[model samples]
Target: MAALEPERAKLDTTIPNESRIADYFLGGKDNFAADRAAAEHALTIAPELPALSREGRRFLRRAVRFLAGEAGIRQFVDIGCGLPTQGNVHEIAHSVAPDARVVYVDHDPMTVVHGQALLQDNERTVVIEADARDPAALLTHPGLTSVIDLDRPVAILLFAVLHCVPDDDLATHIVTHLRKAIAPGSYLALSHPVSDLCPEKTAKLAAVYQAQGTITGGRRGNLRTKAEVERFFDGLDLVEPGVVYTPLWRPGEETPHRPDATWVVGGVGRKPRRPREHPALT
Candidate 1:
């Protein structure tokens, strides 16, 4: 708790924090009055906000399982990881592979504090306070590299986070920068709310969220079109059924109804391995 004083000092309970609002949407009690009010206001615009939140979590679970189970990846770096909730990255990854190592990064001070407290006893996971827009700093942070090796094949999760980067150029830079750092065969999994599903409705919803502000300084929410979201995976090999609606990504069975309500597209892409060098003939 001594570490919480500084983190708490940096917080403003009056302005709704994006992570806390997300927690409220997921039926968590860690939010303040401002967070609740903002979430309620957003619900008036899009009544399906809560459901979309749940669907997002489902996509995250499925994606994590695929990475730690099928892809055989043991290292994970989950950036912009919001408040801890059920089926967290480490919990899901550890279920498949007990040896899996995970590092959760978030810019929110409270989120980092809470995550640190919750994960204190868990040796396999650690949380650090870092901005997603600055990929270099967060990627190279001693706290992050300590848990997961950047040189190895690591799975980077960006679930419901990038839209916070209002600047398209910065978003592109963040993803491309990260892609360059990871070794060949590393994976990137992301889910983003898209404007392609219902442009007018999403636009209004975006307006509502903008009014309340976000964690990424003064920049408002930027809901990208499905095509724009897919561009984040450039230079990587997309897994099967690339960048589809959240529930449709790999639902297997028990598919959720009206997946379009989620208004989000998700996909997993792997960095292709380098071709072996040719031997010099004698």
Candidate 2:
């Protein structure tokens, strides 16, 4: 709670927040006026923008189900987890394994507040208010320590958050650091908004977000290409059908196929267990 105080102090209604805007698009009531205005502006440019959000949430849920049921991952660190809504990470994970532990990380004060409130009664989950770029801080947070085991296989969920990280180098560094820091069997799941799908629409929507001062720290949205999105999985072994469009990645019967204009890509990868070196000949 003390650690989140700094993030709480940074909360302001004037600056629209990416998480809140996402919540708005997801049809959650956790967003404020600024976030609604930004989402409304984005809809004017792309009326199907809300579909993108829903698709992203579906990806997250499916990924969790796969990890918990198939991969046997009981611990999850959901970075940049936006406002908690129905079918949250914990709920999806625990649905498969009741003992699942989830640590949610986000820098938005309202997100932290809402997350804490929503998870207060859940003993196996916690919300840590911190920047996603600082994986060290997030991993070392007291809340995470209380809920997760760093040495055990865990799933790091970065759903719909990578585009908020503007700096390519910084984003790569963050993923690289987490890859090495967590256990060898750990997994990374990510979804990013790609600009190549509809360049003009992407630019227009980005401009609207920027003009609203959508406080994703300093970046607006940095959409990427499919190839560019693959870079985040450099050191990890991608799962089957790797790095495909969000709806196309292991689509379930209920997953709806979207047009190229949706532009979001997602994937899940595992950090391979490094081979041990043999002793020198005596």
lDDT of 2 at 157: 91
lDDT of 1: 0.83
Measured by TM-score, how close is model 2 to the native structure? Answer: 0.91
With candidate 2 superimposed using the best TM-score fit, by how many Å does residue 28's alpha carbon deviate from the native?
Answer: 1.7
- Ten contiguous residues with the weakest lDDT in model 2: 273-282
Alpha carbon lDDT of each predicted model = 0.83, 0.81
The TM-scores, one per candidate, come to 0.91, 0.91
Mind giving the per-residue lDDT tens digits that candidate 1 earns over 211-259? Answer: 6665352344447899999988877888999989998988977577478
List the pairs of residues colliding in candidate 1: none
Candidate 2 displacement at residue 174 in angstroms: 1.4
